[model samples]
Target: MRTKSEARKDAIMSVALEVFREVGFDAASMSQIAARVGGSKATLYNYFSSKEELLLEAMLHSAEQHAENVLQLLQTEGDFSQQLHSFVASLLTLVNAPETVEILRVAISVGGTTDVGRRFYESGTQHVWTEISSKLQEEIKKGSLRDVDADRMAMHLRCLCEAEMIRNLLGAHQRMSASEAREKADCIIDIFLHAYGSTR
Candidate 1:
């Protein structure tokens, strides 16, 4: 039921995300995004009023997709441990992608100064935390996970995992390899199992 314009917007936004990640906000130009998207700068401007707007839109788009995906995973799956595992894997897949690192790096550079920066944190990063927190709450209620406060658990998970992950993600080889990510995720996952895995 989506319109062609909507599809085109998605395409433009996707390209913009890559460009923003690559060159960053201050370095990335509208013309560069237009060239990447096969459009003129004028045309790109018509769709988005400014660089900040486009970046914010792309950040929101990524967040919305992630939230929807995690929620869907929670709804369709019956196993709490499996859902947590799947969520961790999928979330890492998103975060470890080269482009995603670019986005986060660029955001960290601009996050203190722009509306888009603020929106990205509020809507994208924090939103994921909120969704994960909700999922944890549900699992606790179902007695599939240990009974713990969901928000604190969520924050702990984010702080313990993602905070360290940024250093790994931005390391010299360009990004974390699959094996490396597995090792990193496994360590925290054990903590999750200890605290939340089903106990008889």
Candidate 2:
């Protein structure tokens, strides 16, 4: 039961994402987004204080939608290995997605100039890692993973899963195929398990 205000805000954010993607952060203007949304600049302002704020919210909105699916792959439906592999595969798909890579680039470009980058890191990336850490902690409690620091392990897992992300973002290589993504996920899980898999 979303309120009209909430729905309107989401519509604005969706249009804002398109504007950001087309012209990027610096070149994008509130007027441009407002026009695209068929609303006045004042309307957009009512929902978001500034273009930076709107950009952050838009990227977060997109990320949240994608993150929900990825998070679901980490469910406790199977063994820890199955969970990790599925999670990593889905994560690879998400990160390598064109929309996501563009958002990362936009965030990085504005990182020094504004707080949106850091805020996105805190609210988006860190939040996802926290969710991952919780899953790793559960595995540890079940003796499926070693009794190491779950948070640290989750960080390591994230690092490994995203090892090639920079290259993908930079266009150094092509987007991986589904088979390739799954293979990479398997390799990442293998490495993680080698280190953390309980010897018991």
Per-model lDDT: 0.76, 0.87
Candidate achieving the largest TM-score: 2
Tens digits of per-residue lDDT, candidate 2, 13-116, equal 99888877777899999999999989899999998989999989988888788888889988758777887888899888778777777778888889899999
Count of clashes, each model: 0, 0
Q: Give the TM-score of candidate 2.
A: 0.96
Error of 1 at 66 (Å): 3.8
lDDT string, candidate 1, 1-200, tens digits: 99988988898989988888777789889999888889899987888888889888888897788678755765664666666666666666666666766677777787678766777778778887887788788877877778878998888877655654556545642455666666666777788778767685
Q: Model 1: residues >4 Å from true position, as ranges? A: 177-183, 197-200
Clashing pairs in 1: none
Q: Given candidate 1, what's the lDDT at residue 52? A: 85
Q: For model 1, give the 10-residue run with minimal summed lDDT.
A: 164-173
Q: After superposition, how far is residue 119 of candidate 2 from its true place, in Å?
A: 0.6
